[model samples]
Target chain A: MGKRSFNILDVTLRDGSHAVKHSFTEEQVRQVARGLDQAGVRYFEVSHGDGLGGSSLQYGLSAVDEMKLIEAAVDECEQAEVSVLLLPGIGVKEDLEDAVKAGAKMVRVATHVTEADVARQQIELGRNLGLKTIGFLMMAHMAPVDKLIEQAKLFESYGAEVVYVTDSAGALMPHEVKERVSALKDHLSCEVGFHGHNNLSLAMANTIAAVEAGAAYVDGSLRCLGAGSGNTQTEVMAAVFERLGYQTGIDLYKVMDVANDVVAKIMPRPQEITGSSLIMGYSGVYSSFLLHTHDAAKKFGVDERSILIELGKMQAVGGQEDLIYEVAADISKRNKALV
Target chain B: MGKRSFNILDVTLRDGSHAVKHSFTEEQVRQVARGLDQAGVRYFEVSHGDGLGGSSLQYGLSAVDEMKLIEAAVDECEQAEVSVLLLPGIGVKEDLEDAVKAGAKMVRVATHVTEADVARQQIELGRNLGLKTIGFLMMAHMAPVDKLIEQAKLFESYGAEVVYVTDSAGALMPHEVKERVSALKDHLSCEVGFHGHNNLSLAMANTIAAVEAGAAYVDGSLRCLGAGSGNTQTEVMAAVFERLGYQTGIDLYKVMDVANDVVAKIMPRPQEITGSSLIMGYSGVYSSFLLHTHDAAKKFGVDERSILIELGKMQAVGGQEDLIYEVAADISKRNKALV
Candidate 1:
């Protein structure tokens, strides 16, 4: 086997914010950042779970300003670069500038898979600021291979340094991941990456598939601390990559220590594939919809699975949270009529 | 895209016995069996975790006699066949006869990957008793593909109906599993099967790889209720098989209900890849070595990871429980000398 080399982008502070409801304190961010930096992590993402400017009532307010959190991580890291995730509509030009000022050296401009055109301006802005710019195509499973290739090419044309097949719903099988990532690697000149969630317990496998298909960069979090069933566990990924003869440049023992001693302590609950999250993957709904669907289900006294299934049928994507309530209400109304 | 079909042999009562310390009560057995049978599970294995006659001072004692538990499952199941696992030395010819008398219609004669010859007598005995005989090559990761094929061929020649590439250590990667199972499928006349452990978090992926490589029978436990981090979750496998266009003959909703309603409640703790278990997978130690290693580590005041790594270096396989203590004591003595 070839000694394949790749980069590990740790997203614990950014994507993990959703697990803690965007309430990561400065000290916690600094501790995790410092630990991962010592473990030889090359890139560390820090932001609101939904990205910059995502701390409002709907997305849940941040305990500390994301700029402060990013600065905290930046102050702790010696070798690792701090990064941020910026969804197109939620995070505007000023937010990107502010993130760069807070010492974020990379920015992943994320968009719904079908709407890569919306990320063009932000991708160019990130490059202008001299940040390593990446275009993240979220919910990559919903689109066909050709559509993904087209979107990835758009990212490459916009001067993005890398494009990712982000399995936002954790709905993809390994072969599907291979097909989509292989197509992007073939069609685009920029490096390809993959971001995975564990809603269906396939995050590690899908990330392995992405690497096998020539992904140059991949996303993981300490203890799998992300949305839904969380992202792939960073330490486990480091161990597996080492076993597979991939050059991740990560100290496996150090990463494992960080995961156990630092990140595991702060987690509210161990991230397992719960019934709602499993339904999310099975139905192709967005990962972040988990909490909202639970609340809606409880309020309407309806099953969460029904709400998720209806949303899946409607082909819901991220930021379409209002549909959760609508689906729940409809189910509740039908239940009352039956009664 | 082809609609491939495979048999899902539920081993919750057998392998899951390890998680519960061989303490499955008769009622619990009946409940799980009835639930899975109602959900259309084709085969249900019931025995001590280490197979028949495994309950002793060395291996934890069974809460109830396994024969009684097997009879309980047999009574509850209407369509699902009751199966039992029998390791040749631990379970002699008499245990197979007893299992058959207790209504077990199938028996998997298990052995170390290099010791398949030991199962020849038990395999023949199972056939004579009108049992669906399966030859289980435990720790198949320790052997090369050609070696695995040769051993599987021996099982086929001995009249075993199926031969399994059993990853008792949870050590094989997806590609490795594919190679071994594909080789057996090509060379053997009998059906090929796969049994996976989730110590490395690759059970589902490895099982999928095995199925892709022409395995006709696959093993899973409800809610991943087996050894180490557990086996592949049965309900999740059913959902994934459905998503991958594979015919599992399982009702997805029914299986999910059984997992959530029946199995989850009985589990002492949720089976996530813990630190010790992760080391087991990383070091290629047997999955069942988890609790024994933990006990040895505590008694010797040594690190569990060190014990597991030493075991891996020695290439320890199943039924090597004594080695865990030996490794732990050696590390303890070395530490004392340094002090």
Candidate 2:
């Protein structure tokens, strides 16, 4: 088989900041960006972990403004394209403009899987601003293939260069990934992208499945440093891709060095599939809800698994974090009644 | 598609001993066995990391005799069938007999993928003893599909009940796994099994692909505690299988608890895909060679990747630990000459 070409949009500075409680400083962003740049990473994603305007208290405040971090990343990643994620409600046209002004060359307009309609304006604004626009449908596992296709079409209609089948919960099986990605690839005129989480330890496998299903863009983070068990480690993905005789156009050893020397130092903890994280994946809960659920469970004296199960039952999406606390309290009260 | 029923051979005690340097105590074996049995795991593999007679200077001596470990597992596992692994060059008939005496109801006679002939006598001996005999072809990625089928046939002719396309290096891609397993299932009269390592972090995906392609038996270690980055975590595999709507007759939470409370305590290092381990997968070197190569590299002041690449060129198989030292020394000498 011929070597397959794909884009690796690394979201280390963006999605990964959640693991560090959105506390990424400008210097840290610069260092990570510099490392990624040196490793020949073509796309560097920089923003608050929750996307633009996500530095507020509900998401967790960033130590430094995300715009500062994006600017630092832009300054350091001279050769790589700097990108930012913007959720529709949290980040409006102005936020996207601010990010583009900070030198972000690309913007991923994100929304809940079923709420792609909400992302239309942002994607349009991103494109109008002359930024590379990618549509990120968060919690994509919640939608069926037809629904996912319907949602992806909305992105395409809004002029998204890429439409992502984002496995926000790390819940999609490899077969499911194949089905969804192949269908999206078949239907969407725009290039298909995939973002995976390692909550079930299936990120690399799912990513590969997506690639085989003709996904042109894949997202990863250095050291797998995103929410839950984290995203697929970019270095490992690059290595695996090279092993399969595909060109990632990135130096495998350089990526490894960055993961080891740079990313490892910033990691609050080594990302492993914990019980809560596994439950989130198994129950198809959002990956970003892991830490929130843990906190809620502790605060309300309820089991974290119960909180996760309830959240999953509620079909909570990325922006629904307040529901975590509400669900925890309700469960805690119910359990008290039972006792 | 209808849900498929496949056998899971839990090799935590057998293969995972490598991470602990073949030093698993009888009590540890008993604890793990009891937990697995309670979790409804049907097959419990207990042996040295290098198989039956692997308690030697070359493979690293076990803290307790493997016979004792097997005996303990057999005693603790009231329902699960106790199993053991025996490599051709490392183990002999006497060792197989001893394992059977220790109440190992099954035995997997293992050999290099291309060297299935070496396992023949052990399989025959195991069958004669009325043990469920399995043929384990290690480092299966080294062989082509036709060669693997031919090898599987060799094991079948020797009275093996199952023939495994074991990805001992964790090198097999999902498609490759699917193709090889499908071919084996098509050609072999007996059931086909798969043993996966997580060197490239593709263990679970490859295992799923193998199952989808008709493999009957799949192997995983608790907490992914085997060589290199380790085997697929039994808990994660169980969770994934359950999420895929396949009944493994095991409680996912119980497996997770065992991994968290018991296996985590024993793990010397958390299993993450390291550069050396990735090289093992990329170069298709034996997973067990990771530690040996690392030690050799550090001792000789040579690059472990170089040693692994050289080993790949030489097509080194299991029981070739001595060759790692030789290769490392040769590389060091050549590098010195260059200087």
Candidate 3:
């Protein structure tokens, strides 16, 4: 195997939005973007955690307009290219156009692993607009290697420059990640990337496995400031990459300072594997289901873990959050009967 | 390779003593010990964080007599056998004898990787006292494969039933752990065990790697309650082992309940990879140096990371904690001169 070069995409402004309930102010975006840019990071993703136009009643509202946050990050970045994430149903073409107007140079069009066709229009539009178009298959672990390759190929055919195997549930083990990433590398014409969550405390290890299996682009957030237990921590990933003999072009000391000084201040709490999050990972449930599961568990008087495990058994996907209530109510009813 | 059967040793009452400042009351020990025993964990280690007789002004005093805590654990446990750790310099033979009287069925004689000779007397005494003698080589990352084998051989020759490749610093990556554990497994006659810390957030991954490399006995603390980001979490490790097809003989839900209901209440704070602890793992410094580094940094007005890095460069061992202050003072003096 040849040595593979990897790019670190700082997702603190994008995926991290979920951890903070989409409450990043424009100034916070500017601070994190500027610090990461100065620390030699080449890519900064800025958007609502769900995607562009994701701020609404259903998915928590953004504190500041996401367009303005994008503009702030784009303005603060001197060397880094700003990126935006867009899921087809959550974010529309207008949101992508506005993001481009706000100076986003790349757009990662995200869809469920088996639903790549929904993102075709956005991938084509991103290519036409001269932005770096990347296909992001969320919950990639839900599909087998062949299915992942088939979906990734669809993205490449739709003009995506890169394709990512996204572990939204943080459920895939290191060997599983390697197998998926290697399959994509073998089958996809476009560059392969990986986005990992730390719900199972394997984000760093899974990212390493992806890189070793030929992933060229990977995602991280400062201090793991994403959803659930958050993404792979950006500063620690840089340090680990350096130790692993990967040239990430990130200044280790500068990134560490940014994580500790800038990002740590705005974080509501340190990202950790709480019981709910651990159960989410163990049950292979969606990362965003954490709060919903907790709420349903409380409202229905059921254990949050039982709800998550039931969802996993049902093979629930990202958009199936309504099932949380169903699962909780069902568990509560069963327990009452037992009593 | 054939199927591997692994045993998890819950160290919540032993290494976790460090995270709580040796403050486990007798009742708390009984609760955790009984819960784990009921959950089918076969081994429970109870002692001061530093080892037997380690409670002192230097290592911090135990909240209750360790002998009583051991007795409490022994009294509560129906299936699990209580174990105690004895570092030769901190815990002498008399302490081992007392621990045996308190119903400790096993004694892990700990010494630095290069100083296993110091633990020979303790190992022999434990064996003679009808205890299962295990040799614990702490800070094993500081030595190469040959040195580790040489030291582990000393323990086997001293009548140890098992030898451990202990990552006390939490510095070794998964591949590095695989190398060390495989080396020990290949060279040693006795069974090999692994003890890990989560300083770099790789405890779970490193422990997995050790198991893959043929380690049979592994250590974990409930909720990762130990020094410097704590050890591999016992509940989480059991979950992962189940996923990996390893029969750990641990009931997952029961262990999770023990962690959440019994152990979580006693945790002062969640074990996390703080900036100081992250730097410790990155710099390969001792896990116990976190508090001292923070104190020295505050006193001398130096960055804790700098002190840790300097200590890593000097290859400082466990007993050389005074160097924390010395390094801090040197950095402070140099900074002042430049100013």
Candidate 4:
């Protein structure tokens, strides 16, 4: 709200709900919305339905109650503003107008790196509706820096308030973030933002790298919930900002408590993988193995054979819906027998 | 081996077994040994029992039977020679001689960056036994490049056959790898080698960067099995070599098969993290969020919320671990439950 204009945008009722079925109740959204408001997060993404009818990726999950969303937008962020993101091939002019009327002060428009030009119309559309538009290129690193600069500038020129760099694929390294953010600052006359995917496990690092490299706004889901590896964690960024000598006006403990309650109510923690997990992520490789190693080890004596057998079959294990414990139990059974 | 000496060092029994526990069978080692020898990797690091005898953080996982290692070494590798790694605080002159008589052709003397002078004695001692000695640093990045040069020069004066530029932290970006390796190259007349961690999910990238930066011998474990996040995947490096038009004498499909089989039998495939993983690893920041987010997602229900929660607990999630699935699960679970 001040000179720097930093805001924590919670998306528990938005992006995170996508993982389940976009089936969040009005009550859950209301609680999270109020938490975000109380914790001083200035903005919230009211799911796609709040603007567009529904999301293209995760169908049925959108802000249908425009009035409720606006109320939360106004109430959850009494001191701050609310931001909504729109995807092309989804939201039309009518939806844009509806979003503005719903109290979305800022609108983020995202497109593929190659399709930034298409978002030009959306940015202009958002501006004409009296909403500040943030231009975003999903999978920013899919294209080169020069190309990214060209695209970011294109959106910024067309009434885009900020050029948002989105690492959708989670494929970029930190230096890439620095190099690109700097290039955006140097080339574009608009504030730059960063949204990262956890695929590379560097979402927080990249977010820090971006902010350090001059990104004004950082977009992370409440608990870093979104597609693939998920988005950056807003709460983490708040701490990062705090540590770097900036008073973000974020009641970090308050925000964190709300975030934990929401996230724990929403989901359990993920397996902390190393070695092969990292390699697979780095190589753009996939084969399962998630958190199976430790569980399998606990079950099957932790022998090389057991480990390899688990490794070989992890591809089968990963896509198996919610079988982490059973796999561990199975392996532990064998391990116990061995002992 | 040619002037550049493309030696395929099989530390699978050493480094690889560490990841899978000191669980290597005489048969498993022999199986890999015979295959690696047949495939024509240059050097075989005779199993030092996964570095168990070597205690400090300096020597990782030393527990393969040395005599059996020599027996396996002598029987399997027809053309590929042998090398045993020497840790300063662990082994004596007697161990090196025993290794030599046991038919080890070379020995690598390892030390921390501050202990390069310490390796001079070990290097000289190993050299006297008709062994081609290499000086290795465990955490090479802890020291500056100038210090690295100093270490290399000292080791070179002690008749070290190669001066290895190790990024034990997996901390170096590609550029840094090039800079450090080249700096070491400039200071020493001996060949340069490199070993890196996968903390940043850049083990393969950094190793490739090192090789491209003029590291003659690349140090990697089969299936990338080793301490912490583990070493680079030798098969991946072999693929890099093949692509670069270098003769690695590696059967890509064969190596892949063995690697796959080995991992399948003894270990889980490492988690596949994408861009964020590399960035965090490169930035050298630690946060448990990466691992927790992914796992917490599954534990909770909403991948997004878990990601946010973990990201929110940035201080709490202070080191890299695998969490791709955890993030996805949290987001999805919350979405389903709340929706």
Candidate 5:
């Protein structure tokens, strides 16, 4: 096979913040960003776990101001370009400007897979601010390939530099990834990326399938410390791309060191396919609901899987973490009556 | 896509033995087998971590005699056919007969991917013994597609019922799995199978690729309780297959119960891609060597990743556990001198 090349967007500080309850110290961000920069990872995502303006009661507050974290990451990363995530509903134009002012060089405007229409203004604002704009289609597995293409076209029309098929629930199969990515690649002029979760242990494989189907940017986290079973592990993906004869440009050993040293220390818990995580993937619930569901399940004395399955049945998406408590309480009451 | 039907061979007992140091008690085997049998898994593999006669010094000894475990599993399983692994060098004809006496209805003859010739006698013996014979190609990622097809043909010539692309290191990409499984399916007249590990967190994705490429038999373990990052979780595969509109025959909720209740209790550790396990897949070392390498590294006070990388450099295949000690000692001595 000829050497295939792609860009890797490390989302450790952004997505991984959820796992640590968004309590990443500025020093933690600096250490990881510095290590990743030295390792030649060109794109680094740093923001609140839920994106700009996401530090609130429902989403859980960041221990440190996210701007401080982003600024620290930007200052420490000499070669790597800092990026921030912004969900259109959760963030506004001012928040986007604030992120840019904090030295974020790129901004990913995210929306639910079918809600790309809301992302148009955010994408436009990001471009107007002179930051590279990416359209992130979260919960890509919920929509079919044709719908994904339609969404990608919206992002393209809005001047987004890249569009992603983000498997937020980690529910996608390799064939599903292939179909969606190939569709987006064919329909959109901009680059197509894939972000994967490991709730079902298919993150790396799905990411590989995405790359094979012509994904231009793939997201990973060092040690897979993102949400639920976490994201596609950064070091593992580097090794995989290297083995597949891909020009990743990043040094594999250096990334592995970052994962082992800096990322390992900051991890709240090792990412594993726990019962709640497995249920999240199995039920197609959002991966970010893991900790909230676990806490509610424990508090209500209900099985976390039951809460996850109920949440999946309701088709709960991101920013609906309150549903976790409601579902767990209902399930606990039902179980108590049975007892 | 049309609905595709496939067989699931649950290897929770065989491959999972390594995780428990091959110490699966008779009751544990019986419980898991009964649950799986009730869940409609047609094939069950129960053996020592290595094979029939694998309870020796080189391989860890089982706490209970494997025959007792096999007999217990065999007696409890109502519908599922019991199978045993027989590595050519590790197991002899008498061991095969003993497994048959213990009520094993099938036998998988395994060899290194490049060493299929060693498996010919075992396959022939299994056929003559009136058992359903399977040819297991271990460490399949070590060989190229053409070499794997060449080796698989040898198994077919020896009258094997099915040939499996067993990813012993969990190192295969979905495309590679597609190439190998598709090749075997096209070249061999008999059925093809794929067994995956989760070291690269690609077990489910690789399995999906194998099925898409026309593999008829796929293997999984409950809760992924096997070597390294463990085998593909059985319940997860069932859920995935069901969602993809495939006829898996196994009950999804029933298997989930088995995973949550029985298999969860038996696991020594939940399988996640640990640093050493990641090195095993990155280095393409044997998945089963994870525990042995960790033990040697700890004993020698060397980093397990270094030992794993060195072993991978040596291209150590399964049954080469002794080399782990030698390499770890050398690495420890080198680090000491440098210090």
Candidate 6:
């Protein structure tokens, strides 16, 4: 109710580069680094270009060597401290030490709720080395609020500097975000962060919801790139924080310039809220929207065209594809072939 | 808090058509209508298909011949009763009556908050004719909350069946939608409907936010059609509602079929979330997102590729170009280019 306050942690090069095919040339990274640092972004999540845990031979984490990526961050980025993200079980203790030594200002450990202890162990190590540490619950929406609180408690005990609320499936609305964040805020001493997907088109809204509900930081990609619909957009949420009367410490326009000059050249333009994402949104399904919509189409014996229109509507009614089956079943009951 | 109620008003045809050039051949309308009707939508907002009123003859009212579009609705649409949208000060009462008589079950009058009273007179006329009516406070974001509520009450007194929280600029966040709808509901007798744009990429989230705040109906287009970022997609909102344990009568997959095959071919897809809209959004200046984003790009630009890329991030930021300008200004002040 009073002036809302929050921090903006931008993972554009790490996550946003996903929008650009996870392939930032050193030149491209340098260009975006200049803009992102100047933009006032407080944190730059310097990912290994590939997803974490997996060997460099794997797609995402493998795409960019962790050392090279960290070195780039260490050398080129300033103002916005460099934070490297790692999935638990993906990296060993040695990997963690090497990562930080390579110049990462911080390391965030990601894992499922059940694996919080495993993540906690690593966070403690990161902390002992004077590295700020964060813990990420990959699917915060799926994890019960209590489980999240409990897991975060353990992470905090293990010296996690921050813990995140992640809407992995893009399934949450703002109210849910508020309710969840409010609940989580009470249980953690460390800053609470948020990572959201745009599958249901709530990335910025949910991120803002988290901020307003007392999340200390919100995570965003340059162009919303990561997994399916990608992560919350850094520049967008930064604006939301600014408007709510809080300083996001980022220049959103400069970020957008990077999206134009560098990001687009690398990745396919973000898929707009297409029929599939929309349908998955309505279906109440928490699956990858692109994949689920395609699956639902085949399951229904309906053409992709038919599914596309339905996908948008389905997005609003999201649940599980089971709901899609239910809606389709209801429609089929009313009229066979629907034509 | 009490069962979390929300409405699913379907405006797939009216707004979605904007994406398709407002050119729904009779067959396309019929196809969409049949699919929508069976989808369980609460209301069908069918356009007069006429080009817009006022200045842009081609875009609004002039786009469609009212009688012809109605005839199409009567013939093609049977499931949902029609809510014909009319912009006040652009057209007259004659068209309203004509629309109702031609089989439009209801009429919606749209105008800015200051112009709300002008719209009330027409809604009054529609009510007098035993027609259901709604008063839309368009660009509600631009209108201060307290002022808009008073305006909403005026329509309620005039027998307006519904008072819509129209985020014409897609500027409102989920929390704002909750606050606005809650405020309006406290004062109004009629049901509250939510119309949204995707300029800030919060259309679905804001729509659901309205629902969570106890709004009875959620308004949106087919594929997030209409102005910038497009309207909330009917399919998307329906899916969101379904996920939240409510109902939005829409066939998710079936809707997609028509959207991809017929709608996509008809109207060129709108490239949403542009720089101007972003500047406008950040400035808290709500303008026409559709017109500002794609249309402007088509007309003039520094460069097409750069403008389009800028547009998406701008939308991602919710039309907050002022922040962008500020960011750019800050960078310039520092004697540095963003990227």
lDDT of each: 0.90, 0.87, 0.90, 0.64, 0.88, 0.66
TM-score of each: 0.91, 0.90, 0.93, 0.59, 0.86, 0.79
Best DockQ among the predictions, by candidate number? 2
Per-candidate iRMS values, in order, are: 1.2, 1.3, 1.5, 9.6, 2.1, 3.8
lDDT of candidate 6 at residue B111, scale 0 to 100: 75
lDDT of 6 by residue, A1-339 (tens): 447556677777776655555566666667767777777776777765433444444344345565676677667766768888777656777777777777778888887654688776778778887888888876566566777788888888888888887776676777778877887788776788888777777787788778778898788876565556677766566556666677765666777676555655566655565664554343334443345555665666555434434544444232354555554445444556455
The sequence of per-residue lDDT tens digits that candidate 1 reaches over residues A84-202 is 99998899899999999999999999998999999889999999999999999999988888889998899989999999999998999989999998999888889999999987889
Which CAPRI category fits model 5?
Answer: acceptable
How do the residues A1-339 of candidate 2 rate in per-residue lDDT, one tens digit apiece? 758799888998988988999988877888889989988999979888889999887788989988888888889876899999998778777888888889999999888889889877888898899999999988888988999999999999989999999898788888899999999988988999999998788999999989989999999998889988899889889888987788898987788888888888898887888787788888898656878888998999987887887788777776799999999999989999999
Better of 4 and 6 by lDDT: 6
Off by over 4 Å in 1: A287-307, A318-339, B287-307, B318-339
List, residue by residue over B23-104, the lDDT tens digit for candidate 2.
7887777788888999888997998888989999978999998888888888887689998889888888899888888998
DockQ of each: 0.52, 0.57, 0.54, 0.03, 0.42, 0.31
**Docking level of model 2:** medium
Q: Pick the candidate with the highest TM-score.
A: 3
Candidate scoring better on TM-score of 4 and 5: 5
Residue pairs clashing in model 1 are: none
Quality of candidate 4 docking, DockQ: 0.03
Query: Which residue runs does candidate 3 get wrong by more than 4 Å?
Result: A1-3, A287-307, A318-339, B287-304, B318-339
Residue-level lDDT of model 5, residues B212-280, one tens digit each, is: 999999999998988888898898888778778899999866788888889888887677776767777
Per-residue error for B298 in candidate 4, Å, reads 29
Candidate 2 off by > 4 Å = A92-94, A287-339, B287-307, B318-339
Better of 2 and 6 by TM-score: 2
Structure candidate 2, residue pairs in collision:
none
lDDT winner, 3 or 6: 3
Sort the candidates on DockQ, descending order: 2, 3, 1, 5, 6, 4
Candidate 4 lDDT, tens digit per residue, A9-85? 56655566555455555666677777787888777777553235564443564434544655555665656677777
